[model samples]
Target: MNLIETTYQLNQKAKHIAKVVSVDNATMTNIQLRAGEDIVEHSSKNDAFIIVRKGKIRFIVEGEPVVVTPENMLHMIPLEKHDLHAIEDTDLILIQIKP
Candidate 1:
């Protein structure tokens, strides 16, 4: 199992991201964001699983905004347009699978 500790201190800037675990050419990334941090509306070429590790995240799917908090997750179908926003200090893990 890939074990990781959520070290808040290690998460700085957050503009980039902190690598957590990846295998077999797969990519796993964890991002810590302060309140108000958000990604612009965009589409994904690969399917993505967005998990809320801490705090809450506000996401828009099909033009409707949905709030996902700790223990909550959402799946983005490939090439789906969406918007993601961090309502509060949030930590999110994004798992990407290459097709």
Candidate 2:
């Protein structure tokens, strides 16, 4: 079994922050955002899974707004337009898999 720690310090001075945590069979990324910061609408070529690790985030998927908390997650299908807004200081993991 592989164990990893996802703890990270938020860069309050930056509008957005992201880093690759691990990658092999798939790509895993750690993304952090301060309240009011957001990722602009975009689409991925691959499917993706997002897990809220610290706070809350609002995901606008295909023109629908969905609020996700630490206890919940969001999945994005390939080519789906989506955007993310930090409702509070938030940390999340994004796993992407090529189809």
lDDT of each: 0.79, 0.83
Checking candidate 1 for backbone clashes, the offending pairs are none
Residue 36, model 2: lDDT of 88
Sliding window of 10 residues with minimal summed lDDT for model 2? 11-20
Clashing pairs in 2: none
Model 2 agreement with the true structure over 1-99: per-residue lDDT tens digits: 667766566754554455565566578888888888889999999899999888899999999999988888988899999998999988888998876
Off by over 4 Å in 2: 1-5, 11-16, 22-24
Lowest lDDT 10-residue stretch of candidate 1: 7-16
User: Tens-digit lDDT track for model 1 on 9-88?
Assistant: 42556554677787775578887777788888998788888888788889897798889887678888888898878788
Q: Stretches of candidate 1 above 4 Å error?
A: 9-16
What is the lDDT for 61 in model 2? Answer: 95
Candidate 2: deviation at residue 56, Å? 0.4
Instruction: For candidate 2, give the lDDT of residue 2.
Output: 65
